[model samples]
Target: MPMTSHRAALQAWLEAMPFRREAVAHLMAAQEAVYLVGGSVRDALLGRHGYDLDVVTEGSAMALGRRLADALRGAFFVMDREHDVARVVVRQGEAHYHVDLAGLRAKEIEGDLRARDFTINAMAVPLRPGLGELLDPTGGLDDLRRRVLRAAYEGAFRDDPVRIIRGVRMAGAFGLHWQPETEALALATVEALRGVSPERLRDELFNILALPSAASALEHPVGQRTLPLILLLDPLDLEGALEPVRLLEQALAGAVWVGAPYGEALEGYLRQTLSVGRERRQLLKLAALHLGCGAAAPQKAEETARHLRLSRREGIHLRLALQALDDPLWRAESEPEPLSIYRYYRQVGEAGVSGALLALWAWPKGSTGERMARRAHRIIAAWFTQKGTLVEPAPLLSGQEIVRKFGLTPGPQIGALLEALREAQAAGQVHDRAEAWHYLKRLIEKGLS
Candidate 1:
């Protein structure tokens, strides 16, 4: 798309948003000099929805924030005095809109542009009346057209090493190539990344991985440099060093669980792979231990689960994936019986079963793995429909119930009995409260004898 047309469309879109337009008008009328800046402009130029809009001005960010709050009836927050950034959050029932105002430290617009990480982001659109021109003093438009990432200034990395990850993220997000000089600077900035806080590093790594093209960037030479830096920060000697690119490829290509546990694991992987810190490494270990059901042996799965502090739901997902991995034929056969389907559901809960099926579908074709995954999805779907529900059976008795009914002391034996009962119920050996009670009674009697 032509830059002129792209800018026109973006202007139209921004003008259409009554609230944003009003906010811009409020800032402009004050004569403090404000311009729409940062990611919002970058994303708009790229023809994407920009969620957060940032504005830079010569006026006090806190003062502008208060004025905007009063005009829009929004809540204002003074973010940081050091940075001179303030946020105004405007809410209209379910919808939320954010407007940020920041102070400009530079003498000229070029100085502000030079302070940004990349050329594309350095470009800004002036909101002042008759000043609608895109101020691209740093050849941002040229770099954007070339789909090349370039540092705004030579000392950009020295000022903020987190830009290394941001560069990778933008490359993946925009499918842009880093300029040779930019690539060199990224490498030079690697050591500086160590000086950044772990939380900031963690956020950047995850944001990069979450991008659709992240898998490809992971394999890139620039992406590879991230690995050693991570290891240096948080050393972990596995049986062997994991190929970071290949691992990301597998993860991106595979069906990902988008739950709390999965999120935790992804964060952990980024941190551990990057060697973020000991606390982060431990979090990743926990997440990996609970990733897939049946992917590992039962004993190993249990051990890993205990070690990593996985929740019940996470443990269930890991176990189900492991189980699906074990029975290649379960997913290979064209038509699986009800019993097989029931067994699959029994092992993995509904979400886990769905996750397993997705993993199978993601398997590359012309391999036994692909065929197995295809067949597994077919069988699982058929059984799920036949049952009209794929809910995992609830435990017939609770731990407290076991204590009350078995006349057993409050100890480890109570847990053993409850687990045994649940297994029996899952195996279809026991049904209803009466059967559960009788079974527990027999186990308690046998133990006493």
Candidate 2:
């Protein structure tokens, strides 16, 4: 792994991955000074498999992005029209990845690398074979060799404080030691984070939480480097919530499983994306982070969710997980009955999946630990296996039925009753149409009373 060979190795790594050659080949056709830059270069050097390809070109980056999309059979988006940033996204079956192409920030590759955040990310290789040698103007190669993380310049964090979060994440992700000055600089710039957009802060936080070391790094025994960011969470009780995250990350990373039987379901539960494509695992951590926050967890979850600009689905998932951290199963020394489990799921809906993990991991493993494990296992199994029967029974009473039968207007009451009936059905009190009608009638009577 000599410095020269890094470029050659990256060229081969590009060929092996799905999108690289097609993107580089198309960009090479442009006669622009196309170079593989940023993490696309760093990750390849470390032999880490990465789906993202970062490219900078002398020509219009957006135009090249559209052409690369056409060449790679992907979709192109003008991610930042004013900033001359564009993205090409490609889907590979169940998973999707992207390439971001941007016009050079500076006049040349050397200047562009100098303006980047970190030395390791500041290295680049020409996209066209034999066009040039590996470019390392800022000692990125030396930093990588020393396994040390360093800011590209003194003002890197000041320029974009979100890089501080990214710096911590990369440190955890690659196990790179912080050059003391870089760490000091990043810490000094924490207040500047307030000026950063909520979206940028959020995406970087997500990236940080996605790391296997996220929980420990954020709450490290020595000191939590991310405490400044956590304090921004205010009353959410986000601090000291890493236990659930620790467990969740372990399962997601295949370091542990919820048990062999429900392994697939548990993985899917953690991996599934919300409507806005944000990860459930990250939101789960946020929900449980406030477990110590008690009554404030739900409100804090909602407030923080709004600040993060999470999708409606994502917000509900986070808020609900916090809302219902305590459950019958977690309380009971024995596994709760199906009806209890059904009620729990009914209360939180889809957040039940996340809440279950939070509860399971946060459950202590002493004395009755085995029972709680069994309880968690059964509850999670029901979510994937028996949800149709015991958890979310097919609704017998539709909203249309309520409006027609009850002579009621299409309003809040109808919606409330319809949702309640699903839980009632789970209670096994309403098995058939006749029983469902009687159950609704009793509910209406009870409401009027």
Best candidate (score: TM-score): 2
Q: List where candidate 1 sits over 4 angstroms from the true fold.
A: 2-7, 231-362, 365-368, 371-392, 398-410, 441-449
Report the C-alpha lDDT of model 1 over 65-104, residue by residue, as the tens digit. 8988999899999889898989999987777889888889
Total clashing residue pairs per candidate? Answer: 15, 0
lDDT of the candidates, in the order given? 0.63, 0.76
Candidates in order, TM-scores: namely: 0.71, 0.84
Off by more than 4 A, model 2: 1-4, 90-97, 129-131, 220-231, 234-239, 251-261, 395-449
Compose the digit string of candidate 2's lDDT tens values, residues 148-170.
98999999989988888888788
